[model samples]
Target: MSNIRHHPKTETLAAFAAGRLDEARAVVIATHAAICTECAQAIEEFETVGGAFLEDAEPVALRDDALENVLRRADPGVNVVTPQKPAGDLPETRLPLSAYLEGSIDDVAWRAVAPGLSQSVLKAEGYRPGVLRLLKIAPGVRMPRHSHKGEELTVILRGAYKDEIGDFAVGDLADLDAGDTHTPEAIGDEPCICLIAAAAPLRFKTVLGRIVQPFIGL
Candidate 1:
């Protein structure tokens, strides 16, 4: 049995395996799958099924430049990044996310969003109507109650938090859609840091959240 209590839904995982998810959301799933055996196995199964479908499909002529395009994309210099050690109290970041950071997680330039909360927004080329960011919450800090407009994927990197849905720890992924809503609060002595990918703007329930939402861009 795995220790992780939260994971992406089957439909979400299937989209990830099929390469249909945007880069912002795909990074979250990949990072979770890196530490979660169950999700990883499920993703492998989906890939196998997809492969079977591909094998049965009719072959099509490829563009003359397709081979060159593939080789260029596959080149290590263009697509590969070596992993580095995390500094200070930050948890080890998996490969999918490590490629984006310049150094350790501690080195990230975080901007204060609210009391006891800080965030660092990440840029994803061609990703629209969505945002990927890292949020660090101090222990006992409660995030605003809110629901999603489209979909949201969050993976814990360090410490833990509790919400209406359930308690979340390191490697746990909270996969939520428009219908789900919750306010999460950091629980442990250490700060709770998570990588979040939101497909659309969040719907804040409280006046404070609404007022602050524009500034924080959550």
Candidate 2:
């Protein structure tokens, strides 16, 4: 993220390393780690550190049906559905490593929030605590300004959005924290689709912006 420092908190990475994050949320971060070497290294460090802790820990025996219960819960058929791709002409941008034709992100439900902004929220699939929303920004439209209550990671899907930090094209990931506050304008002729995993609802700083918050599902 240009002008914004959005490194995941140590605790978050630690949770991810421990198989504790929600499946869908984990998928998002996993995608991020694949593109951001810095985050990948951090995840590696977390895993390395976690492995040592695991080695030092004692094994506990599960009750009679505990294993069966876990197995049932872990059934292969159980998985989160990816949202469908928004139909529109999108500018050139980086898509996540997921399949372009069909994947986890090509089958969820999308809801409109504003004139050029729309989103689809996925069910939390694992230990993740917040909601994951896919946002589609219309071209040539600037989003309402806002700040986050917690951390937000935006993975560019199609096209680009620009702010004071700079332009983020396809595959570009922006990590924002509580201090970030900027309006993003879809700069290309086509629309921009971004995947955002956020723990808290966004706080629109302007009253007029806030008035539109409910409509935007932010």
What tens digits encode model 2's per-residue C-alpha lDDT throughout 45-146?
A: 989988899898898877999989988987879766667465433221233434322344445456788888788775553454677767888999888888
Tens digits of lDDT, candidate 1, 1-218: 38999999999999999988988899899999989989999999999999999999999989999999999889988675764565434445445787677666778899998898899988864445667889999999998999988899999988999999899999999999876899999998999999999888789999999999988867
Judging by TM-score against the true structure, name the best candidate: 1
Top candidate by lDDT: 1
In model 1, the Cα lDDT at residue 55 comes to: 98
Model 2, residue 88: distance off in Å is: 20
Candidate 1 achieves a global lDDT of: 0.88
Q: What is the lDDT of residue 136 in candidate 1?
A: 97
- How many residue pairs collide in each prediction? 0, 17
lDDT of each: 0.88, 0.71
Off by over 4 Å in 2: 1-15, 19-25, 35-38, 58-109, 125-128
